[model samples]
Target: MGVIRLPSQSRLLCFAFHIIFILFQQTTAERELKFVVVVFRHGDRTPVVNFPTDLHKESEWPQGFGQLTKTGMQQLYELGQYMRKRYSNFLNSTYKRQEFYIQSTDYDRTIMSAQSCLSGLFPPTSSQTWNPELPWQPIPVHIVTKSSDRRLHFPLHDCPRFDELQNETQTSSEFQNRIQPYKDFLQTMAVNTGLELNNLRTLDNFQLWNTYDTLYCEGIHNYTLPVWATKDVMDKMEKLAELSLLSLFGLYETEEKSRLQGGVLMNTILKSIKQAVNSSRERKMEVYSAHDTTIGALQIALNIFNGKLPPYAACQFFELYQESSGRYSIEMHYRNDTSKDPYLLTLPGCTSSCPLEKFAELVSPMIAENWSKECGKKDKKKDIFIGFDVAVGLLFIFDLVLLYLLYHYGRCRRRNNYQDL
Candidate 1:
């Protein structure tokens, strides 16, 4: 037993290593991601709708029209893997039903994309698999039939008020200003492409979007476009398509329009975030596999859009955290480009890590107290009821006036009679 002591330099080295280890442990033990809500457009797929002149008809696609392509599946698979790496600390490494959830629009492409994405996100391992040969596991993707769906899908249909809003938007000074410069080009496109266009103003949002999508899909698949689809025409169509997107709930009373459309989804997302914070083990993450419109609507609702269509598989992530100060906050990120890390998105009125309550307050105007009422689905009934009440009030006032006139006439007659007497 020798009284051996380490050299002074060695003692200092040991002390430094101990301190570094403690700091690393503390950093891990202290910081935690409490909740996550990730919403993403479905991966690349066949165009949802196409023009009559298009060479790629509905039958030309693998599953006919609007089906997910193999390329689309791969894209979502890659996206899921990216999510796994990005949230390795927050989410469990293994597939755990209690830790995660997923949903998608009620479309073949979206539903399949959800499955493909989940395959990459939670590859089956050990007892989680039913068959050793298959690396996939069945994960439920919640969705309502298109007819009943309201919250997850964007540019919701059957909302006549939203349609009226669009009518006004197309007539706005800003809308005219943006589209005025493209008047000649739009006419040229209609003439050349045989796309029936009565006038520049008649280029409705869906029509513009449809043209752009056809050209875009054709270009990507290396299909030969007609001579009419020149670069200039395509460029203008792209601009018009962008404008069409803005026309959707972004122009004129943007907040109120959002409350009736994207805000429904936002509320659902926030609800999940709040729930996750309250119970950590119950749910760790929520994923929505939808369309480009879904992402666009959400971006505008969050007031963070960058003025372009979100590309295929684009995603918006809502990450929740509990700070050491005992307060909860939200962090948002957009992942449109796979080459780089997702960019952090800050609410225009708040910091990147906005407090949860503050985020709710700032976004409250966009969330509808009653979605159907906001969409004016019951406007006719409401109008009739109001009209009836107003009519009743007017009748009562008219009766009062008639009675007063009668009383005045009787008083004058009685006074005259007395005077004559």
Candidate 2:
């Protein structure tokens, strides 16, 4: 009312300030994440085999095929230490029993890896030292079995759907094309090994994949691989292993299928994080001990397949942080090789730091069902038989009545015939 008008620039500045203030307040009001879900590949192990006819096949390794090695235990222990250090801020000064959770596939190696990692993660404090002699405390590691298992663990045996997927994968155009050169290479190797190339496919067990994993793990642990196993050779083997994993679960053609493997896991992780953010529970770390196949499958499902496969002891981490302004953000860390710094992954639609809601939305399409509502329409023509037992009983009664009538009619006809005679 003072006939004086504010400058347009000043008015715009005031509006900007208001928006910034509101955003800042909103950011400050948001909560920090306390929950975490970790998914990891198992640690190192011995080569699954030497060669088909080689005397050392399956006997060279002390623990036999696909079992975890000492080196694998060490690798997981180191990973546990890394997790402890990285999440120190988020976790309590002492390990709060309730705040942590671990899940693994029900393989000896995976279960053992999870146990070993826990050993490194929460070493016994002085107070918890045992018997004034040894410093050991039992920590629980949860596992999901192939049957009734939601975690999608490996050596995923006995799944009909998974088997179908694998068959489709082997016959797919992409797989056939990719393996054509490898098929020739196998033929050459067959000549060298004196084993038939055709037999190689048929004779190979799941151990083929395990052999590749063990060798890669050993190489990482300073156990030099044979000259025959060059970086290129290992790379090819890793790809093959990944292909096997895709065969297990990544067979669907739609984006939803993509999301199911990738998005479902991601969603599970986010939900855990959200729960952590809201709850006062103590556990800040979640560990998932699994196989390289799990990593490959999840990556493929998420559409984030890095060129190389995730080797044994390879780890992927999702870190959540609260900024000064109070907004929450996320960072992804990946460690494939022991010598390198953890690689950072910037999720699509997510920044080096991403919002929780955005992260959920990104994977929602993958996890959400894609069936049409119209397709779910009920068939009115179909009888809704309540209590199948009762329906069966009624049918039995109707059958008895018909039988009784037939028997009486026959008797009556017989009596009439007797009278006529």
Candidate 3:
């Protein structure tokens, strides 16, 4: 065969193309995405509870209090679609149980949110379609009772140490100073909303967040705000609500508080990352359908919180990548605003693509080795209380038996006397 000669320009073009191809391959090999863990808040919903004096009632909502609204389902469905687009290349078109897992808090809103998200993420493929008319497939969303779900639920009510720390945080000079500006506003809110100022300030369950959240939800749905819930008042309420949330996870001894709250979820995520790195057939992604507090608690634990309530359908991503050097790195991203790209979050002491070891080390202090132990819970006391109750019951039984025997003996003696007479 005769060798064909090319012009100088043509030779140069070929050389450039060859180099580009080689570089693309090298780049692809250098950064391979291995696994992803996404934690997202439930979407918009009716207010959890109506204020005592508010015109809006729970009955007005299509679903009663705290259940997911149609709008909320749409928000999550859109979020799931976004996830599908974002991970199209990474995830299979068909739902594969071994390749993906999803869990949600055991609330009507969260469970429904997960289902909605899944419907968007994995519409039934032709082969998997059971109902041709309906474009959805059933994917189990694992859940535990809210009381027992320590991983996803935050501000754990059972953690006495957490409660103590929160109380201490409330009393700190910093907290007092922060709330000083909101005192008048809080009092005004108390008068208008029929909520006690003291409880609104101190109780996590009834914090100012509830009021702000109720108003926020109403405003979104175009309900006319009461005269007292003016623009300025709403703004102040938001600030106070944010402050209240921060106080729960931060404001004082942030690291210690996180260990008992958000750290539990962080621990689970870290374990999953480790498993993905070590296992051969690892799941591609794990989804957690939770609440705003869940995201807030996690970000606080990681020390990357943005100091605002996570908006409805907001999501946080933990992505694990293997570098060319045979080491894994983690990248965190927060997607709160739909208009903007997700914010890149760096571990305080490490770079955005933090090394696995470095990431683990930085987060270790926040991760509790034993949640109950760290929460200052003592099983011995429970055992002792149980023992005392058992002992008291046994003594009562013994007394009853003695009384019955005495009555029987006295009745027999009387009968014998009557017979002898």
Candidate 4:
């Protein structure tokens, strides 16, 4: 070493290099993440409804209301194949029974759709055969029953706040503007079906809305709809249904419906991701098969409604990756068109893929408060409805009182007339 101490500049340069090296190493560690979560609508099925005058009704379909059609099966199978191809590298060479998990709403269509997906995703290969004679082994698809249903299931309860919101929305200037063009469409439907639009307006508050939902559900269940329902008509109906879902849960002022429904699903997914991250599990795909309403509500809650309505078999995906700098990024993908690559979603002040934590934080307010607690209370209330039967008993007493009053009034009038005579 030179008798002169190492220059201060050289020591400073060394310190700076060390810091840069540490940052580089940290960055390198973050970029190696691979995790994915997906929530998807069930494949096509029979319509939700069939108007009284419509030629195509529930009888047209072999499986009654809300059943999956053969076409739906084909659609899901194709989707499964697509997933297999897309994630071949991420998944095992052969489908590992334990590597992936699937859950669906406890409906026949959704259950079948999940099964169909599994069929296409992990077709029985020659190598997987424990016995040549029996090539297939049952892959479990978990479902929450209607009685014990959770996030991905049927019979979503009515939220009074959401109901109030819907009423407000019906009267809103925006809704009025949106429905103006559809008025002509409604009139045409009314004319063809012999349903008086004025009668509908007076008698049924949501006549048109109900009509569309019925058609939409019936279509998904494999029933043929009326000829009047062209692609454009069905498209419009889908939009209306989506609006209904948004009104149910996504509306800001109403009871936080999104939190109860989609918000719960999001929380579950996040919890799963966190678990995976902590456990360092290489397997990172989470799949949920649910109703169109689920997807619609989630999309609305996220404020990511693409103009086109999400059809049966629609899928929303969230991919999480850690960057080299130890930062996590999230990417949102939507598969509205099976043929095309999923469209990327962009969040304000963030890329389509933002940090997982940030994504949760953004949606936290929308999550319904005490959701699990409320759900528990609901179960208890449902039991009371059965045990007490107060609603039914009250109706019975009211009917009796009305009949008594009517009879007494008639007798009094007759006596008065007799006295006058």
Q: Give the per-residue lDDT of model 2 (tens digit) for 313-352.
A: 8998877666665656676778887777888787777776
RMSD of each: 5.7, 8.0, 7.4, 11.4
Cα-based TM-score, every candidate: 0.83, 0.73, 0.86, 0.71
Candidate 1 per-residue C-alpha lDDT over 1-421 given as tens digits, one digit per residue, 9 for 90 to 100? 8999999999999999999999888866775788888888887777777776776677776677677788889999999999888888778888888888888889888899899899899998777879988999887888888888876777898887888888888788878888889887777777765676754455574776877887787788787888778887787788788777777858667987888788888988888777776764678888888988898888888889888898888989999888766788999999999898899989979999999999988998888887777677876788899999999999999999999999999999999999999
**lDDT at 55 for candidate 4?**
70
**TM-score, predicted candidate 2 vs. hidden true structure:** 0.73
Ranking by lDDT: 3, 1, 4, 2
Provide the overall lDDT of each model, using Cα atoms, as 2-decimal numbers: 0.83, 0.67, 0.90, 0.71
Model 3, range 232-312, lDDT digits (tens) per residue? 998988888888778889889999999999998999999999999998885999999998889989998898998999999
Model 1 bad stretches (over 4 Å): 1-29, 198-202, 279-281, 379-421
Deviation from truth (RMSD, Å), model 1: 5.7
- Against the true structure, whose lDDT is highest? 3
In candidate 3, stretches whose alpha carbon ends up further than 4 angstroms from where it belongs are 1-25, 380-421
Give the poorly placed runs of model 2, Cα more than 4 Å off: 1-33, 49-51, 131-136, 146-148, 155-159, 191-208, 211-239, 242-264, 278-280, 322-329, 368-401, 407-421
lDDT of 4 at 360: 69
